[model samples]
Structure formats: C-alpha cells, structure tokens
Target: SADIIWQHCTVVLISPASALCETFNIKMPPNINVLRGSCVTIPCSFDVESRFEKYLDHTCKAYWSDSPSFTSGNAKVKPTKDMTGDLTKKDCTTTFNNTRLLPGKKYYLRLECKNDLKYTFKQASVNISVIGTLTCSAPAPCWSHPPALTWIPNRGQSQETLQENQDKTKVKTSVMNFTASHLHHGNKISCTAVYQKNRGSPDVTAETSLTPDISYSPKNVTVSVSPSGPVPENSNVSLTCSSNANPAVRNYTWYRADGDQEALIGTGQSFIVTVSKVKSTFFCKATNALGCERSRNLQIDFQCNETQEGQRLPQRFKTINEEESSKPKSTTQLLRIS
Candidate 1:
C-alpha cells in the first residue's frame, strides 16, 4: 500500500506568483448612460494570445442593485454574429433591451471566459450613471414667423437662401425640418403645435429622430417612361414619386416649366399624363411636412408613324427572308439572270 501527501509551496512556488492562473483579459465600454427606449450597445472584448492551442469562450453577466442575485435569468444571452466562445477579433457587443438603470444606484457587470485549458479571466467591475435623457435645450425652441421672401424664381439660383430681417432664417410652418445632427442623433426631438383644436389644451406634439448615415429629407425618387420610351397618341403616361419623409406625404404638387405656379397633383404616389394628339414637357414635385422639392424636367416627344421620303427608317430594313409581314411595299426590287 502506498499513500501520497500534497505539500504546500514545496517547490518554492516555481511558477509566477500572479493572482490568476489564466492568461486572458476582458473589457467593457467606457460610457454607459444612454437614452431611453433606444437600443444601447454594451461593448465587450476578449483576448487569448499566450496559448495558441487553447480556444476562447466568452460569457457576459449584468446585475442591477434592485435585481435578485447574479443569475442568467436577469439578463438575456444570445450568440452574436461573430462569436463561439472564440475571441480572436474585436467584434463582441451586447444590446440591452428596456434598460432600467436606476439613478445614483450601483450596478455591476462581470465577464467570464473559458479556454481549452479551463483558464478564466474576470474583469474589474465598472460603474454607470443612468441619466434618463440628457437634453441640452436653449430655453425655448428657435421659433420664426416665416420668411418674407415674396417669390422663388426658378431661373434665379440653383438654391435659394431665405432669412428674416433680423438676419435669422424664419421658416414658420407647423412642422419643422432640420439638418440631422449627432446631438439630436436618434433622440426624440419633438415640437408641439398650438393651433385649432390643439390650442391652449396641452399642445399637440410631433416627435421624430434620425439615425446616422440616413438622410431625413426627400429620397427614393424614381422617374420612368410610360409605355416605355414614347407614348403613342392618346396613351397614358404615369410618373410616380416617393420619399423617406416621416408622417407620410401630407400633400403633393405637379409643376411644369411653362408656368411658375405648381398645381396640386392630387394625393397619390403617381401622376398620369394623358396624351391626346398633343404632348408637352413636365416634371414631378413632392412635398411633405418638411418642405417641397422639384424634380428635373422630363421631355416627351411625339412620333410621326407616316412614311416620308426625306426621313430615313428608324431601324435597319430586314431582308425578304427575314420579313414576316406579307404587306406589299410601294416598290419591290427583284433580280433576273440569263
């Protein structure tokens, strides 16, 4: 019979006197306060450089002081597009749904990762300040009474700039459209209109937000030929218009170069040009709660399907063998050989 006894510090601690037996690291995003009802990305990452033979396993944990003991049920876990417990690159992030970070309360998050050798690295807990919404307002909205410009001449300028006599731009409409900004980035910027039924009784508000890389103005404009290229006599030519404006399009107008006045082109996504022995030049213009913008002019040409000696054929003449039409021509050519 043999017995074995383990001795403490017997080899004088040959290995490095480090706290952890694993060689890996984990990190979290620096800033945490995020807007409410919006998606927030809690970025995390793992590194396993020392042991090439080992694999990477990543796991994230979140805790709120008011919540129960640290449990997986407290948070949602799902495999991202670039993770299988292998942390090779910096593509680790988690999105929290309906975050309820209390104000001035302590919150903690711990990350755990395992490798082929069972080595684990735990990160130092971080703190977060939950500010519901950080809105920096300038007392009241920069309101204006409307630009005093009498007219907008199309041939005048490629783009017109309007302003009030006080050197301020005053575009006074119920709805306001502004150039997208990061500060107003994905934020619920709203405006309350006090008029009509909404006057004096809790202003009627309209809220909206825009993400980066997205243009909030009129977009997705399309122009196509009706009945293909040219519409024959008494044919229907339809021109459709679309945009990315919110609240849909309140109204639309159709305009042509012949007149400065823009006629209301009904409330629909398309306009039809009825050709009855006559055709003209026209273009489409769209408007919404934001503003109105005109599209480039489109030319419609008529065709004379009659035969004329001076004009050449629109297409190359086919040989007799290829011609399927049995109709006789004004003159036919034939050759006789002896």
Candidate 2:
C-alpha cells in the first residue's frame, strides 16, 4: 500500500516501488511577480517514470491547487486554460491570462494522468506576488509633434530563460508602445505577461500600469475686466488674464494696444489702470515652457462729463481701426471740446 506523506511542503506517495518514484521530477520558478490585471508566464517542466510516461502520452491534465495534496475535490483548485506543455515531449510550459493574482499568496502546480494508478504530482508550486503597475516614462518636451510613450518592464525587468532537457522549454516576454497627448494625461496604461504550465489549463498573468506625462502650451486665452460697463474718467479698473495650460503658465504679460503697436504695460496676471477720456484696446500674452499664447484684444471705453469749470468732457469714444493702428503711435490724444 502507498502511504501519503507531507515533507518539505511537498506531498509524496511512499510505496514499495518508491525507487521508481525517484524518476519523477518537476521544475519551476520558486516565485514570480506580476502586475494586477495583466498576464504572466510560468516556466514549468516535468519528467515521469517510463511506465507512467505512457499514461501521460494522452488524457493528461495540469492545474494549480491551493493545497499540497493535489486533490481534485479541493474547491481551491484552478485549472489552466492555456497550457503549452506536451506530454510526448515532456514539456509543461503554461501561461495565465489577465490574472488578478492576490499579493502574498502561494499557488501550487499539480499534474493528473488518466491511468488506473491515478498518478498525481503535488510536490511543486509557485508563489504569486501582486504588485502596483508601472507608470509610463516622463514625457519629453515637444514643439511640433506629440511625445512617444514607452513601456518600462517590471522592477525585475522582462527576460526569458531556456531550459535544457529531453524536451526544450522556452519563456517569452511582452511589450507595448503608443503615442501620448495631453488628453492621455493621468490615464492608466497597462502591460501584462501570460504564462501556462500545460495545455488546456487556465492562464496566469502579471500586469503593471503607467500614467502618461503629457505637456502642452496655454490655450483659449482671454482677458476679463473688473468693471463690466463703460469706464468713467479717472476711475480705477483691473484687468485679469487667463488661459488653459499644462505645467501651468510661467508668466503673464499685459499689453496696451496703441494704434497698431502693442506696448508692454505690465508683468503679472493682472493689471490696474485709471481710465482716461480716450478709449483703449488691451490684451495679454501668456507664456510657459512649451510656448506662448496671446489673448484677443479687449476694448475699454472711457466716458467723461463736462464740468461747470469749462472743462469739456467727451460724450463718446471710438477705438482706432486695428488695421490703421498697427503702426507705432507716439501719442494717443482724446477728443476735447475747446
């Protein structure tokens, strides 16, 4: 009678034919780390006794078990859907797809053959460690084209190993690439590696994620005035400049349109001025590392009142034609009733 014994975290059957049992061997990585929601590959291989080898020639199955007993009745058993192993060749390479493996959990590998002896191996297992996804590399600055987003492999880095045996087992790597834009900022990009231990078995996967760092210049520039209506002569008014930008605007320059020339009036996001009898056109330039954007010209009208002291107050003001005002003007004179 064969007696089941647990030793070194492995389940083994000791029987009179225990010498033949020594021929069986299983090889796999001790542990693997994967990104959540991604795929992973498990490199696996095994050898069986010559007599039992015939049993594995057909109708053989592979699976992952939560227990070392390798019992099929165990509810914790997970079957691989994508097993690449060939019993004829004695290869047991397998892949797991989109595996959401839990962190700090161990999953064991098991094999079953459809023979009278009901051969099962539960001595080999691999631990699964779930970790945070990787982020996309920092965006490179671009003036004419969008930046390229490159994928960085896990901390362990992507690598492949070849196993030398009667049947050769090979491991492969996964990669992805894309272009990034401002719209993709803060968006998560993921990479997954899938692994299988045998044919028809469920897939196991490891995944990681990255957030794109997209840079862009200011857009939709506009200027706002504190007083909504016509400005009274000598009244103080405030002008605010605003725009949309990534990495934020580094500087805001206020400008006053004199005839056709724009004169830098102040530096900052806001400007203050005392209204004169003359109407004036104002605009602002917003700048950042990427580039600069100018706001649409704003026209401020100055209204005046005639005083009993014989001071003539202008009743209305007109903006100079932008086409004609493009030339530099040395003086801006308001209408006066002499």
Candidate 3:
C-alpha cells in the first residue's frame, strides 16, 4: 500500500510540475559581457512547481556561484549588498559588481526560500566575460529612457554601454577612445550626461572633466626683431626667439649664417648684434627637454649709401623663410632718409 501511495503521489506531482520532480525553471540570458571595473545585470525570471508555491515569499533570497555544484546554503558569491533579485514576484534578476575579480567562466544561480523551497538552476548557466577596460562611467538610473552621454571637444571614437551599479541602478558608460597625441595636452575634456525625464519634468545633467599630460617637441618657433624696419648703421638691434612647447623652452640659441656656413653666436632669449657694412643673415633656435626648433633667418642689410651732401644712410632688415635663405641677396634703393 505504501508503494502504491508513493506512485500516486509522484504521478500527481508530475501533473503540476514542469519536469519530473523538478518543476522550478529559470529564464535568463546564457552569456553576458561587461567591462572590467564596471558592473553588469543578469536579467532573470523563474517559475516554481505547485508543491513549492507555499514556500515562495518575500523572505526568499538569491545566490550566484562559480561552481555548478553550489547550493543555496553554500554559495560561492552571495553578495549581501548586491543581491537585488526579488524572489516574491519570481524575478531572479541579479547585478554583479566589480567584474574584474570574477573569473571569466560559467556561473550558476541558487535560490533559497524562507521555508522548504530551495533549488539550484543547473540547466541554464550564465557565462560572464570581461571584455575591455572602462574609460568613463556615469549613473543612469532612469533605465526606461537612458541618458544621453557626450564628450566635450569630442575628439575620439566613442562607444556607449549599459552597466549596473552596486545599488542595482543602471549606469551609462562612454568609452571614448583615441590615440594619445601632443595636441591633446592641457585640453579640458568633459563628459556630460543628460537625462530627459518623461512628462514635464526638467532635464537632469552631470559632468566631469580632465586634462591630459603629453610630451612634445618644440613647435611654432619664431624670431622677432626690435626697432621695426630701418635703423641707423652701426646701431644695436634686438632679436627674440619664442616657441610653443610642453615643459616650456629651456634654451634659446642664436646663429649667424654666412653663405653655406652657419655659426653659433649667442645663448639667451634675446640677442643683440651691431649692424655692420656687410649684409648678414641671423636665426634663433628654441629648445626644450623634448626637442628644438630653428626660426627663419632675418637678413639685415645697409639699404642706403651716404649722399654727396654728407647725409647719413639708414639700415633695413627683413626675415626670409628657410627656403629663400639660399638665394642671393638683392640690392634695394633708398626709399627715404630718417
């Protein structure tokens, strides 16, 4: 009679249960990918057998384990603060935090009820794979309509992804990527997140900024001479060299070019040379820790000759590009006397 009663009970249980003796079933994605240092959510739902209906309550808890053999009582990763799945409604959704520590592999879910309803869903497993590194992240709790993310001075190729937080809130992360260049140095890059609420609610926004440090060689090196245009013969003139560079220009050098030969004349931000009867070509070099640059040549010439009436002639100066430096000098007629 006992055998007959046991067989009858088994047959009755099978009618209400989804599978033989095991009526509980869970629905969730098979695989999930997330960025390192970020969080991810495993959306899940489940159905319980008729016999276990009495055990379904708010007191039920969810657990995730790395090993398939994990039970409700012996869970490998039971995040006390992060287990967000509500079992009362049959929602087994769970959010995992800081995926960097979780090894990339298959993980199993275990449910523990306040009473006798406890089961481990081994039929369907979730594989957590850490795909890439996180570049930037911002809170996006409004999952219904996710916030729009943008970068200031938008320079790089960006990709947007959804992640979860410890509090089970979704996060909108923007991975703006670009090759590091010296041009990006000292640039104030900002990440702004705009959340457009429904109805008539005002839009909410958040922003963050950072400046990148980059090393680069000297650039835009230029030389400027004082006492613009013509000057008296045998008078002193000032030449200054400047450049745009990181770490600033540490050294400044002045050079004189005569024909095919070049000679170093002085060392400083400014160089003063006395005008002479012979025409001359001069240039300055600005240097920093990374590299150096040479400015265009400034050609100084005696533009005027003494008149028979004993009037003194004036001197003239002009800068030429490097390409024109090799060309022969041309004489200039006296336009006027100072």
C-alpha RMSD of each candidate structure in angstroms:
30.4, 31.2, 30.4
Per-residue CA lDDT of candidate 2, range 4-98, in tens?
11111111111111112357777776545444345666676778777765676566667665445545556254545345577556676766666
Return model 2's CA RMSD, one decimal: 31.2
How would you encode candidate 3's per-residue C-alpha lDDT over 1-338 as one tens digit per residue?
A: 00000000000000011122246687775455444345667788888888888798877888877566767666767755346666788888877676422332356778887788888887666654222211567666668777788878777678988888688977777776554444555555667778787789998777666555444456567777787667777788898787766667899999999987889999999999988788899988877765566787788887555778888765666766422122121133111100
RMSD of 3: 30.4
Writing each residue's lDDT as its tens digit, candidate 1 over 1-338 gives 11111111100000011122244554665555455444455665545456633343333322223221344344323334332223334334555554433222223333334423332233333343322211111111244322211111111112223224354434322222222221222333232222123346643323222222211233333444445554346667676655444324565566554556545544456778765544455665556543444555665656554456655323111111111122122121121000
Alpha carbon lDDT of residue 233, candidate 1?
Answer: 61
Q: Candidate 1: minimum summed lDDT over ten consecutive residues — where?
A: 7-16
Candidate 3 overall lDDT versus native: 0.64
Stretches of candidate 2 off by over 4 Å are 1-179, 190-207, 229-231, 303-338
Q: Whole-model lDDT, candidate 2?
A: 0.51
- Best-fitting candidate, measured by TM-score? 3
